[model samples]
Target: MLTTTRLDRDDAAVLVDGAREKSVEMGIPMSIAVTDPAGHLILFEQMDGAKVSSIQTAIDKAWTGATARKGTHVYNQLCVPGEPTFGIHNTNSGRFSIIGGGLPVEVDGEVVGGIGISSGTAIQDLEVAEAAVEHFLKVQANQH
Candidate 1:
């Protein structure tokens, strides 16, 4: 049998914390979601005043990032008309988001989880998500 690694509660907590801090710094209430490598939700947080509609969006973005093993913003480019992956956004029961704000988390060069941020502009969401991943990596590096 092959050994595999997945994010646990501690890891998910760190990711959420990172994203929340970034959102606060930006003065934007946000919905955040973290998912395991299989695209299953590990944790979710909705800041005060965040948009209710963005809850599911955050989850879906995390799901897409985990399963696809790439940032969802990349899909925004490839999922457009005439692109090879044009219909990718329609897959996974529409859970495959094609917008920004979803990012895969990797450890030791292996994907461990995903983080998603919403309730702001796509660019802003992406910024927060990036902060989350960066924070996680820094914490991991310090621990190691």
Candidate 2:
């Protein structure tokens, strides 16, 4: 039987906090979103001075990554010209934010969820998500 693991509110909050802390340390205000393996929202937050427009986009990116089981930017990478799934952004009703900065959160060698950050530059967004990933890895190692 196949099974799936979902992150509790606490784990998801840690994931968001890790991302937010990194962003602030880098002098960037941002928004962070975390989702379960199935891409349902677990928790989300926006830092002071973040753009109001980026809230849902942040969530969408994380949700898309978790649900699609791939980075949202893959849409740009794999959505080649003439690809049937190209322009999925339109097909998906704007839920697919085909951009960098969304990353999957894995545990036990499997994706338990995902993290997404926005409101800063694309690279900043990546930095926050990467920080969350790093925290997850380090915490998991400590549990051994």
Candidate 3:
């Protein structure tokens, strides 16, 4: 038998809340998404004034993060032409995001979930995503 850890609703909430706070601090409304280890969405939010087009982007980003088990930004470098992972973004029905702001959530060296943010620049979205993950980890650490 195998045992695994996964994020629940409360955990997803923490990620969303953290992302929202950071987005507000940055003066950019954002779309945030949280996903399970399997890349299934657990929670999502789009702040007022956020771009409507970014909603699907956020979800796809989370999907990429969780399923790929790597930050989406990492692919931007590797997914270029002639690279080994070239055309990766074309796979998974085009759900593999090469842009930034998609991050896997790991606990005890195991990926438990993913977080994705959008609506600002890629760098800005990445910053908010990082902040959200950091906040989630801190909260988890304090609870245990």
Q: What's the CA error at residue 13 for candidate 1, in Å?
A: 0.5
- On a 0 to 100 scale, what is the lDDT of residue 70 in model 3? 96
Residue 66, candidate 2: C-alpha displacement in angstroms: 0.3
**lDDT by residue for model 3 (1-144), tens:** 988799999999999999999999999999999999999999999999999988999999999999899999999889888879999999999888988999999999999999999999999999999999999999999999
TM-score of 1: 0.98
lDDT of 2 by residue, 1-144 (tens): 997787889888788878988988998888899999888899989899989988998998898778777777667676667987777776567787777778888786688998888898777787789898898678768769
Clashing pairs in 1: none
Q: What local lDDT score does residue 67 receive in model 2, on the 0 to 100 scale?
A: 74
lDDT of 2 at 97: 72
Task: List ranges where model 2 is wrong by over 4 Å.
Answer: 80-85
For each candidate, what TM-score against the reference? 0.98, 0.89, 0.98
Q: Candidate 1: list runs displaced more than 4 Å.
A: none
lDDT of 1 by residue, 3-32 (tens): 879999999999999999999999999999
Query: What C-alpha lDDT do the candidate models reach, one value each?
Result: 0.94, 0.83, 0.94
Which residue pairs collide, candidate 3? none
Clash counts for the predictions, in order: 0, 0, 0
